[model samples]
Target: MGKQLGFYYNSNYCIGCQACETACKNKNKLPVGIHWRQVDHFETKNENNDRQVDRYISRSCMHCKQPACAAVCPVKAFRKRPEDGIVVQDREKCIGCRACVHACPYKAVAFSNQAVKASKCDLCIDELRQGEEPACVRGCPLQVLKAGDLREMEVKGVVKECQGFLKAATGPSIRFAPEKR
Candidate 1:
């Protein structure tokens, strides 16, 4: 891959509005029951146990370096692009076997009954090629989402993991700025 493309989310700034999810669905023309992006809200007690805290997380395909979906697909429908390292699907080659759906550790892959194929976030490659941000990133009212080179985000001290997310051993491309208590 020429560059490691990825996204970043700051939980501290998220308002749990689901605007990113809505933007993703609208931009991709997703059918009912298929959500490429989702927002999760959870509550936790502070360390002092005096008050409860709410956290909002926006989640999508991480486009991992060692993508389990790509590894498990028998037909090789999933591929990591050499230009930017975005994991994308070749729908014409897919068999609708659901192997990718099961293999993704972040549960990013989804089965589309209408199309009879596995689908997930491709990070809006078309938009990126046009020098535009992904729909989800652009749609965040709170500016909680960002897209850029993974190395750059790491250099800015983005967190690699947080609650309600899979471990980073698969080398997930997304980074988190988790809420601090």
Candidate 2:
């Protein structure tokens, strides 16, 4: 790909308000029960400190560098944009085989039971083209979400993977900032 655009998420500042999730649904007009983006919550209380801890992992398609979805799609319905490296799905070409759904480690490829097709994030391609940020990024009230060049978004010393997310061989294009205190 020419340039890989990806997301930067700071779990520390994410309050799990789900505004990002709502914005994504509203912007994409997705089928009912199909979420292009979702927030996963993790909570705990420090045993010694007794301090409550909550972290929200707001995520969607990783838009992997080597997408297993693309490799396994029977109808060649998926393509990574050469210019920006955003993974895209051609719904018309989909066969409802669910192969992509099975192959994605991130659980990003959602099968729409209503539509009998697979759907995932396209990085808000149209909005990006219009020079607007993705709805999820813009919807975050705490400014915890951002999208940009993968390399540029990476934190200098923080781990790319989070509690529930892994750094797969697919080379997921997401970066995570250290959780804020």
Candidate 3:
């Protein structure tokens, strides 16, 4: 409920390199198939029928103002941090119920086979505390990813909805700069 930290992605600048995914996994020491951050590819024909246009989206937990995952957790394992508004799951309190996984609209929550818990991105709270950007943001080869205060990014004309994203009443924190036509 404090500063709402969020991500901004410029689709025009992304190349679907998956570096962000790699960096997130390495930084969090996540097991295989448990991706806290992921790159998604989309292809569509242009309006003029010239050729296929490919787009890539880097996505993770958006740290929504009303996190459905937190609401559905029977054990109250998920919490939105008061200081930075980062949604985090307390592994110890998680019951592996998968309710959170089902509740999250972005499909960001994943069950970790190694840890036997539901896990999602915490926005690298520790790194943020150190005044460092999240690994995904720092590792992007194209520099397409950015993280900061959501309000500031919005003021700069970044939008919350894009080609692969839908508007959520929860007020997801991430923003997008759509690819140019």
Candidate 4:
């Protein structure tokens, strides 16, 4: 693992306990009502089996292949690493116009009301540099979150589910394997 990038979420294994969510908030030191990561649950009934099954979705920054947030940032706050495609923000340069928030289709970009700037998942580059995984992925009890190379993960048959700007422009590097319910 030489500075690789991307996120892999196995919905089949996720418990929707929000450990990832809390971990992200704590690691980032976000104030109340600020979320860099979140868990979403969708429930559906199987007509054939007369059973109800719930699908849990873990969502955050996709750190896309072609990020709209970076493109729309007037101050050039958003950046993507050419080697790994990890999109990040330079807080010092950010003017907090909320342009990135509007440009992002995934709604992944979060504007800090106090800091007066936008923040989102950077895939925890600092942690990776320290030879550690992102806080959320590490804190997950169910071991559902995996971060690494998109090419390698796809080759391993990790099915990806994309939404919003990601579906249109592939703005994030997050992949998901939905559980069959």
TM-score of each: 0.94, 0.93, 0.95, 0.89
Tens-digit per-residue lDDT, 85-167, candidate 4 = 88888889989899999998778888888888888989888998999999998989989888888777776565666221135
Residue 156 local lDDT, model 1: 59
Candidate 2 structure quality by residue, lDDT tens digits, 1-181: 3689999888867789999999999998887789999999887655465787887899899989999999999899999988899999999999899999999988999998878899999999999999999999998899988999976765576568876677999989898876445
TM-score of 4: 0.89
Ranking by TM-score: 3, 1, 2, 4
Q: How many backbone clashes does candidate 2 have?
A: 0
Q: How far is candidate 4 from the true structure (C-alpha RMSD, Å)?
A: 2.7
Considering TM-score, which of the candidate structures 3 and 4 is the better prediction for this target? 3
Q: Any runs in candidate 3 off by more than 4 Å, and if so which?
A: none
lDDT of each: 0.88, 0.88, 0.89, 0.80
Which candidate would rank higher by lDDT, 2 or 3? 3
Per-residue CA lDDT of model 1 for 84-146, tens digit only, reads 889999989999999999888888898988888989999999999899999999999989899
Q: Let me know the TM-score candidate 1 reaches against the reference structure.
A: 0.94
RMSD of each: 1.4, 1.7, 1.4, 2.7
Whole-structure CA lDDT of model 3: 0.89
Backbone clash tally (model 1): 0
- Stretches off by above 4 angstroms in model 2 are 45-52
Clash counts for all predictions: 0, 0, 0, 4
